[model samples]
Target: MGERRGRRGREGSAVGLEKYWASDPMDVLRVRQDFVLADVDTGSAPGFEGKKREAEKSLAVGAGILAGLQEQLFAGHQMGDDPRRILLVLQAMDTAGKGGIVKHVMSAVDPQGVQLATFKKPTEEELAHDFLWRIRKEVPEPGMIGVFDRSHYEDVLIGRVRELAPPEEIERRYDAINEFEAELAASGTTIIKVMLHISMDEQRSRLLKRLERRDKHWKFNPGDIDERMLAPKYREAYQVVFDRTTTPYAPWYVVPADHKWYARLAVQHLLIDALEGMKLDWPLADYDIEEQKARLATG
Candidate 1:
């Protein structure tokens, strides 16, 4: 595909190629924009050891940014005038590091104000209601951050990919998702959706590592293999979702997950951009410290 603005056009370029070179590096590194840089083909690194090392380095940098953002958020809550809520909806196949991100990226944030919800297969009760009913209950309250480990997008992404629903049903969902997200945006919830993209080979290797290691055995689910087998179909489903749903109100970010650290960094920067854009003001208090000090002296 032809390149526009130094990055891949609409159709994403290879894994690491997009946005490698930018006039101002940060200009290419935007939170809500599409990228089209050359791919960095870091072929299998000597028995996967090199890949692990690279992944760790990227993850560390991302974690650092996350920690810094946590601090900023804490201070903002205490000393700043930001009242907008930030929500992160992480959607990916199993073993895509959703939990790891919660553990590492969010470890520093105050738990009292951060909510995380993990959605799995619908229960008999959940299926009984509209698809979004469960998700609606989990929306973050004011003065809090809500994290959806998996969210309403499943109605479209996984549902269509697995052929769990008919084509007409899938088509109907596109508008529903838009209106749902639009309502959230209109209501003041700043929604950020992240799709973690990992290569098929990387996923297989990660699954194998989980099976071979005793500590990781708990993550070994037979269903994971079945989902991995459907990557191509999932990719197609995502293409449709992305094309239909990437709107000004609620944009979707497709993050490269092979490098965990890089993903974290991108997410951190994106969060910062979103929060900073809010132009938050500190809440006003009735009493004035300077006036109170004067009154005390007079008394």
Candidate 2:
């Protein structure tokens, strides 16, 4: 919006903005847990100085590039190469805009090239195996972008806060998660982990609005109030998660969620960044292009 700072790439693309931010939003919001939850500005949009309408316009352009890149990646997979895939792991508190992200940022891409997984309570069958058993089953196939609405981190986040598992087992999960993610990375998966940070007051306001409207009541979970009561504990759990699992293979970006537009824009930028880094190219045609053109003309 201001003086563009980055080298231009594809036409009408926001991927170049990665170079403009004084610090990339991904790095600015990364979680090393050097600071506590209170230290983050939930309403602040780092590395962006545009209005909602401008951000939305940029998002549309970015989405087009993302869709094109995704198609190339999918095409490569179809041509038999094990192309890298993106697994966007989204973790956040309730009403922190995860649905908005899936609906807005992700909707920019071809649906056939995307996989969405939402994790709820563990099923009785799911409980019998390792915590990651169900998660492993949903990892995106090559060339498709996978979105984990809430992920294995839940076993540590909610499991620790709610005391669903013993303290020692909870501690063990941190290392287990690190190892599991490393495996994913080694297997051609590029993980972009995000934790949407929203203030307590904002969450309270959103929850209240959900309760106030008859239509929105369907989205309300009474259990959310129980979790809200233990917000401080949950924050502490998240800190431990960042400290233990933010790795070079998979780092966590903490997006401020009080402004839904900023959150959506930031996530789209992150996805674009990941895809751009893949350096995908369209698959080569097995048949001669000139011959095929002549055949089509004759037909």
Candidate 3:
């Protein structure tokens, strides 16, 4: 049955999934309503048993597929079709490897087709508007992939942990986010929300390394230590996030990021899955191909 389906099935079909069951690691890492972050082993790669070298090779191949799919998406939009776009939202505790994901996984695709936005502390001007105002501006254009390093989720994560917003307001933001994401999904955006979960011990070691190296010092922030102290609060807040916002349209994937290589590979597969689901085809040529060929031959 698998072999027969392989010859006729789409990339994301059940048959395809069964064929690649051993390779695709996301099946174990995806966040469902009952997902408990504390129960997840941060040091282990759940479904992937491969080492660093194997993961690297897999990433190279996945990158090529991603690039081709992105091009098709772009071409479809250029042809004035209802092209779909991707929005990858990366949310993680400090040093859980968000930057690494962008550097290793995203670097494999066409930079021109990617719309990356790293949200920082809101400016006074931005503060005046809704929290999503800045986020709305950075959403991927038709046929593009948009990545948010830390997205509107910050309002809930940090706001809840730091008491930045009132308890009632923070509660309201969850419903607001669901509505916002539903709008994006309705408009043909495939939203992939990932939370890179790393161990507190792992984070401490990384921070220590950053402080020890002069070159890495710029990346270090004292505020990170402050945040680290509130790890429990942050975890609670994330649990709330997963409960409230992991909608059918935009589910969260809690990736075990202690192994950077595996995290990168898992993310690559997620992207491949999303693109394959798009089932994009090369745009048809508007001009007459035979006529163009004849004209060229005559010339």
Candidate 4:
């Protein structure tokens, strides 16, 4: 994201939206082919100059815009068979704030039009089928925005990192993923895949805070420490995944997650941009307003 800020809607939101963003997050955060995972400054909010206070107010304004667009997406389905929808795939290591993104950002949209799925370790039933089988069942339907906390890419990431699958098998899954995503794009799902990149040191600090607070104890896991030992391996795996799966149909964006406010705001911009691209509008009333009013008066 060193010089990637697009800033398309910085002055104002999409035509009908009455909000504005300081800058475009996607242009700032979208991963390019030359991106190296190791070089990303997890602590830096690259291309963004806004401070926390400005970000908070901007986030609120963005939520209003998101609500309007999401409502139109719902209306599209309610009144017609509009197939447009959004699928936001989030991937990051533990304590990287995937839940925070959902809680703070997506909360702007109507629950009725949003779908949330968290993919943890596979269950017995999930293991019985292809990795995507369980995933396909959870995809957002018409006019819905679906969020995947951790997704099918786990098969390549942890699977490769832990040697859960043989190298050859792991290699095949990447191609399968690309095809699956292409199909989703063709079917009217706008895909936004993001990797919340946080520094190892930041993660350690957050983990310590969790351990210090009894109320946050449930969020911490000893297994996370085990994973930390394998940071080098995990990073290599992620870089490979970025290389293979990112396509025009399903691109990847990596967000710097050291600043919670910045991460949330960056994601807000990504979602807002995706929704804006669809040009959503309220479905027109099919019945005549005058006729309905006259009939109601006579009755």
Give the TM-scores of the predictions, in the order they appear: 0.75, 0.90, 0.91, 0.92
Alpha carbon deviation, residue 275, candidate 3 (Å)? 0.4
Residues 16-37, candidate 2: write the lDDT tens digits: 4443334457667777747566
Worst 10 residues of 4 by lDDT: 1-10
TM-score of predicted model 3?
Answer: 0.91
Q: Please report, in order, the local distance difference test score of every candidate based on alpha carbons.
A: 0.66, 0.85, 0.85, 0.86
Which residue window of length 10 is worst by lDDT in model 3? 1-10
Model 4, 120-170: lDDT tens per residue? 999999998988999999999998999999999999999999998889999
Model 3 per-residue lDDT tens digits across residues 183-277? 99999999999999999999999999999999999999999999999999999999999999999899899898989987888887898778877
| Tens digits of per-residue lDDT for model 1, 22-138 | 221123332333432123221312112224555455445444434444445545555544445778888877776777777766764668768888888989999888788998999
Instruction: Show model 4 residue runs off by greater than 4 Å.
Output: 1-23
All candidates in order of TM-score, best leading: 4, 3, 2, 1
**C-alpha-based local distance difference test score of model 4:** 0.86
**The best candidate in terms of lDDT:** 4
**Which residues of candidate 3, in runs, are more than 4 Å off?**
1-23, 293-299
